[model samples]
Target: MMRWRSRSVSFFALVILVGGCTAAHSGEPSSEQPAAADVVKVSTPDTSPRPNDPGLDAKLAPVVSSAVALAEIPAAVVFVVTPSGSWAEAYGTRAFAGTDPVTVDDRFRVGSVTKTMVATVVLQLVEQGKLSLSDKVSKFYPEFPDGEEITIEQLLDMRSGLFSYTEDVSFNETLDDNPGYVWKPAELLAIATSHSPYFEPGNGFRYSNTNTVLVASIAQQVTGETLGDLLQERIFEPLGLHETSFPADGDHTMPVPSPRGYLYGTNVSALQTVQLPDAQLQAARTGALFPHDVTELDPSWIWAAGGVISTAADLATYARALVDGHLLTHEIDRLRIESLGQLDETNPATIRYGLGWMSFGPMIGHDGAIPGFQTFMGREPASGTTIVVFCTMRDSPTGVRPANEIAKNVFRALHEN
Candidate 1:
């Protein structure tokens, strides 16, 4: 289902591949393994803050730290990068149920940020002449209804008006009944397609995870490789990312020396505070009992939408690579073309969506949230600076706005410095 007309109130809140093509390493066997020494305690400010470094530390550190502390979020990670260099800082305990400290390298779900990578991979195929933007969805999947009417460009641009399954109440009911269930790609789609189109294709804009899932499936079919494999071949290997992966199974554990993630609730709507509706709580509570505290959401549920995980360094590199023409220049152009369709009619100063990303003036990127994670990656293209923030806690009501805002301040501070 693809629905792209949702309002800012709907979005209101709220990356890289590794080389070698190996299956992702499984979560650590024991919970008791000693935490790595390099995992910074996150209390102290970065010692050698770079000269042009946006002094993001000086600008938003207090604000972000206060939010994380006030909300009782288990862990938070901030990363800042420019043409000159990059640095990562960590804060809070790794485990909410215990005393372990959070680490920088830990893997949390990147959520919709995964769309950027998925879009990149698709654009790569387009560049190689394997696919074309004008191609219709029916070209790849004949069974898809109204495929001929829905062009690949529309899908990439979020102009496809299919109903998002995420809005399905029945699907939410089933998810509530089985919080630990691992969803397959087809299964997830079936839920969304069960509903009719939200609006005529190409008439409006909505943020639909299903559009990304479909893209991933199509890419796999055309390339005859898993999305993970393609990412390694096209993006990760060239970039030299040592710690990124698409876990085939539902494991969410980052290796030792990484921050642990904590999921606050079950529903996609309002923040799932510590209140009841608590049966879904046990599987989540596993993060407390196990040392890795890994999660079990089937990667297929997110597919291209929110699947992969990586470190702050890798994310910054990927963002820089995207802007530097390392990825497809034309597709990047397509991404930058502002979608007046999704703009807030009430506030002209507010943003409209872009292909797999968003634009705030000259600053362009996207922010994402899953149960236990919130992340943002943005770049001021003309200035040649990129900012990224990742955290383990998804705040109630507030979402990841703090990390996103901190990233903005970080960039401004660095620019001013």
Candidate 2:
């Protein structure tokens, strides 16, 4: 749900991707990766979604279509639910280079939205007394820099001060050169730990993939299980989210019926204007700033962070669940708000980041981007309203992210009407 912050790059590393990496890691999936259509299928998308709801789609489609045009992206599949009703719709082509149309049921990578799911699993573990949020990283991986000073809570909240390895220009360059490379979690951690921390643990806020990677590793250490298994058992099955699946470890394989993912970075002129964090990264970025077809890269790089593929309906269901505290006890769910920070201080209502999710005013969810796709979701608990958006291509002509921009239109359309 990092879209509350960086909808374009997945999270802090978007600016670091060679052609935009997986929101999961600085965005490396195997170039030899398998597409969902080639893998074991997710439960078939329920055929029940009607073509459109007159009251809902009639009003929302024009706004969305306008956005598709203005954003200069292709193929959007969106789902929105309001007090009035719910609707799912699609527009544009499945591939940036083809005529295959997209549908509401076509799957897209949910990206960092996986973090919300991972957080739910972590909280579930806490509820079961398997672990505690106050537990220190030293309790599991003491080798991590500042392991003793950083707590599980800080990792969950991105206050661990660990560098995000995905931001390493070298990492992104390597990722760009070899999207098929099967990256190990240890290797990624080594890259992150090689640098100094942004600040003392809990002293400042900066999103980093290292925190989540460490969190996932710690969870595995505690349970002796893959994060996918934990999520499948405790979250997906119970929630009846049949369309979701974490890509296999050290690989990228989404469920069947997924659209081809793409990366849009041909705007080298626009990219040159961006002030990247590291000079090395800027150089690497300069070398690979072009449109790319990343539909087949290994997804291991984004594991536990952003490498999730799901449909619009499934995302809406998950979004509502997260907002309503479906998987957690009421008291424990309240902890998600214990330490909150504004994603943008000037527009406080836009988003609030806490734990592993982002709150957009009353709506809750995240946004993600990979080379071939971008995703955004938001749910408003008060009215049972949820907005989910998917696009085959990421970003827009003016640099406005289509995923978040479409959701903004949906939210505004509902409230203004």
Candidate 3:
């Protein structure tokens, strides 16, 4: 449910990608990985989605096609399911600057969607009597200013009113210059706290990466373990997601045989200005400037806020668990639902941001985006349906909004049919 505030003004008819090392990390799945028998077979998409009518594949294709066409997205993958059946499709390529076609198993950055996982882990701790929703930030990070005023609930609701450090013009400038710069939790908080609060804590709503960062830090402190470890112990292992991992460093290269991500950049010369494609955009940003491994993003930068990488199948599997109460007991589920109530009024009602996931009509989940990728997934618990979509290359010539539009359109189409 986190929306991007930035927009592109100038459009490049064609773009180029700068190639080099990828900055992302990968780790071995623990012994707790789920059994193969539990993993459901993800069916290939055969029919297009229908809007008002059911039993029509052509109708569904147009909706998805128009959305992709309008967005001019370089690459996209979509999967949807309902009581009747499931369908998944891959469109475009992994990198338009190159000839690599996108496959069903390609991995993509989940951006803020990682927040849902972090929130779920934290809530699980609460259910285990290891953490408390009412706990104050002061309990974990006594150094943070006004920690007492910021409760766990406020942080989850984004009602903490803490100004976002991402909005700092200087931060953006530095980020542009040193795309690989590593960030620390304290540094990120200082940037955020330096600004005034958007409103009183627990009052109005404003989205800030700071809230999730704090949540991540707090979760680690309370559990005496890395967020990644906690996730494996509870969710990933239980679900048996082979492709999901949280690289603390910002390494961009996927493990051996992983799909390559291409970033589009502007190149100008006397002869002509053209877009270039670089497979190493992620590595350059994380390894070179950040001085951190690509596999593990500075845990502090995204903290619990946005550092998560997952496959489309894994994303759908996780969403199904979250919505169906496989992860949260009924008592704790109520708290999570309550946390989503504080979202900004501008977002759609279908999008009621709960503790971690966003509710869109019957669909409940979150979406993620970074510089080169966009991801989203949701589940309709009542109908036992799950939808997961992923796209490579962020902010193309057309724009990034199409990804968002696709999520909504897909949800509506599924419901109507």
Candidate 4:
């Protein structure tokens, strides 16, 4: 879901917000490592009231409201659970011009957040001895350039130098021309391989969706099952994530209780630049121009890389389990935590990317963005604090990731409290 060529602006904003965290650590996953006490037992959301700090709502409500208004997002849901207490709130409306308010339970297309689930399944396969991180890409698809040199770990960590199909000009054109086209995984890979890789495999880092698509394909090849089926068996079922689902190909519908996703510009326009013309920006800000509702656009184009649908509650639960060793064995979880490396070595405060997840400040998780929706999910492993944000709009006219912006402000508010 990351557009490598245009990711700098958004990534810079993230770095500024989370740069105060610890320097990146380096290591590989080893079975000999001892279990870390930071692991916590996973629990479902409590319906009963829990102790909460009175000052939290006062500090956070304005952050969400101001961000939503400034970013021109149609709606958003922010949920935070800390050692002190929990706060969940929804803002704006379900549609650009609708009067219905969005609720915290409404579902959203979580974009690249789906990568974490696919990565979890891949790690589970490694745990089951069906896969190895060192396995070369050529082991499955022998045609890829330097496939022999690319490891599964590289793909999981965004170190794969594969070209991202999403960045291809034709791919974006197709998305704009045929929003309903059902994209197959092979088609996506073909588009990526048609172009030369950004660099030799394992030599550098680039956020390529092609890497994740390949990982999902490999998982399917090894298990002789679809990615959706594997996720259902390994993650959704075990974690009791009833609100989450990977949509079947050709199914462009969102489940009920979901808001319409809005976008200000076309895919090509966004690819060229996230910023809108001055006149358009002014009109949009004044509500004279409304964003197009793209809620039903076929998501198959992103496939296993960015095609999961879930609500804030499910994301909160999944984020906790992802970092707390609930889904994988403690040994693998420790390795995952220790695998984090600075995305930009030059910036010490740069957010670190690990095995399919990221560390920003005290939280470890991922953020996602597609055409009409944006999401952020993270949990502080030590304190068991979790934050989930979902914005109905993909990005602001100024190219800001609305969900991440709000999440960053919320994180600041949490630390202050």
Candidate 5:
């Protein structure tokens, strides 16, 4: 699980800082050349262009293109849907060393954005009377510390105080040393349980991946079905999100036409800090150094928490549908929306975590990060405006989330225009 810092200012204020900057014009498409023997070259750009808004494109294209170049990201895809129209565009190459351009259709891991889907299933179970928001976690995992006091809603909202397993040194070391290892849910839970809670239940808001894994486990125990099956039945199939999938634990390969995911440093290094040393950062910025291709690394370590794969189009569709109440009853959707509370009381407008998702200003949905991939999907319910961004590189050399940063800029563009 990618644990992001919660110290940033409100999205609107931060957007103002980057929105006025002019687009950087580096990293133009190079002449096609033969790919290295080991590199997987994706030649087909099969995505048909969605309805274009020339004015919207003029505002968005420069923002995303500039961000990709400045961040040294291998590739990125951005999709925006507004009342006026929709625009979808891709930027950069499929591989850092190759010439093939990425397409809007290319799939990549959506990471913690999977939490929204898992949370949706939990909410559905509640609506069906199979579970309740007030249900105690101890009902499912009797031995978990303070489980008796933790409610299902607390777990969904990150108020359970459960320690994130991804924060465990051993777990991250394993990820660095054995990228191919397939992690079991129980194993992940065990790592989390071995540690003490960050705080008593509901005392503080901590974004712990353990809370989500526990929720998924409880949901599985209640329905006697795997989470993937539940999502496919309840959310994906009904919404026709054909491009999204919760992959099996053993499957590490990304779908065809997908760009290989890249990362600047090892998991342990990222755990310490996503920022590279100054010299290395400059080298990366100038294209003298490239990120490591970790596209084949197993994602099971973050299953239920961050293991879903999807494309730009699918994410935009899901984001809009989720905000529009396509996956839940009208009453339940209203409750879910109202469940939001300030993630940081000191900075109320920064971001709010609700039942199973988060809100950035008026945009309701979630962002995700895993090794080699970063994604953001959010839709403002009032205007039916959706923004989806996918970046092949997990973060810029300075530790900025490329997808989230680009989405914020895009939002600012819309606001300004």
Candidate 6:
């Protein structure tokens, strides 16, 4: 919890939704759709969009630069938002080799962050009466094991009890064998259905990718369009998330002017090894700092649950609009927020889960990790601020906390001034 370029669905099918929201500030192209040959594109703002500081860029740049070496990240980008305006800045190199530095427009895979958009669409459907939280999965596909007992609400809340397909060894094996395989949503779901339910439907809460895939498939079923089409029609277009996209099976490219994504703490995948002569293996001996270029691999295996490719800019604006409930009514939005379930029993500070996101105190955001990208996005509604951070590596010795550190620094720089 803590959340497509395919199918030509019109974003303006619905009425124009306008707000005082500001577009992202970047000197580079922020489109999720990549251009040929990884060209660098930049666009610096003529006049600073107000974020409560004029020298904010100067202070924030150092934080990102330091985060790269301090946090041992490949590269990092941070986008900060306030009620007045927003801006994004990036530091470090785009790739692991050479001097190809990262720009503000560099797009990266946003892991579980994809969940929030999927949830918004689901709730939209619920509001339209096309679906209901209480509706049983059996209503859509009774053939799915335990379909009769599972509710759509349970699916959105990560209580569906469906086994995450990514956890299946065979799926990982296939992933390693053919990194470019195009996976259909149903095909991915089959891997989970092959196994029995983790528990009974709604019996327990365990974050599972299978639940989201089902939600996406159901959305496709209800809308008579692909999940990518639905997202385009509902969220991306309305929110003006030009730099956001849902890559389907055949798309194996990153956002134009992107960098090579790397992964650490892994032994099974096809990543390059950066082993030291006398290396002190970090955490689980999976191999420290294993560098893999998974940037070109087809990412359909994690569809719906974690398939969205987005830039720091799009996420910044999208986060505020999403948290502000610009697309849905207050009744449904409040219901979604009220559905939070505790994740940490003893020390649940902000570690809570709702319809499609997890909370970290007053900040509502989610972090995600695929093979080579670790992403975190949060919005503090009270201050009308949204913060997003992305790193090219999935994990470091620092875990996924580097992004959070960068965000906190930005928050303090903007608010504690």
What are the TM-scores, per candidate, against the unseen true structure? 0.75, 0.81, 0.75, 0.86, 0.86, 0.79
For 93-118, candidate 2 gives per-residue lDDT tens digits of 76664788888888888778888888
Error of 5 at 112 (Å): 1.0
Per-residue lDDT of candidate 4, residues 310-410 (tens digit): 98888888987788778888888888988884333222124778898888766788999999899999887766878899999888877899888888777
Error of 6 at 147 (Å): 0.8
Evaluate model 3: give its lDDT: 0.61
Q: CA lDDT, every prediction?
A: 0.60, 0.69, 0.61, 0.79, 0.79, 0.69
> What is residue 379's positional error in candidate 2, in angstroms?
0.5
Q: Evaluate model 1: give its lDDT.
A: 0.60
TM-score of 1: 0.75
TM-score computed on alpha carbons, candidate 2 = 0.81
- Specify the poorest-scoring 10-residue window by lDDT in model 1: 12-21
Badly placed stretches (over 4 Å) of model 3 are 1-59, 256-300, 338-349, 396-400
TM-score, model 4 to reference: 0.86
Best by TM-score: 4
Candidate number that wins on lDDT, 1 or 4: 4
- Stretches of model 2 off by over 4 angstroms after superposition: 1-48, 266-290, 341-349
Ranking by lDDT: 4, 5, 2, 6, 3, 1
lDDT of 4: 0.79
- Sorted on TM-score, best first, the list reads 4, 5, 2, 6, 3, 1
RMSD of each: 10.8, 9.8, 11.5, 10.3, 14.0, 11.0
Number of clashing pairs per prediction, in order? 12, 22, 54, 0, 1, 16
Residue-by-residue lDDT tens digits, candidate 1, 1-417 = 443223221121110012111112222232322223211111211222344234544555665566555444567777766555555677877666668766565655677777877887787667667788788977765546677678776777788876676677766665556655666566566666666776878898877877887777677666556666666656666676557777664553445466555554455433234342344434434443222232454455566688778777677777766655556655545554444234332221255576666765455667777656778776666767667777775442234444565565555555453
**RMSD (Cα, Å) of candidate 3?**
11.5
Model 1 ranges off by over 4 Å: 1-60, 70-72, 249-253, 268-294, 330-350, 397-400, 411-417
Clashing pairs for predicted structure model 5, backbone only:
111-306
Point out the worst 10-residue segment of candidate 4 by lDDT.
Answer: 20-29
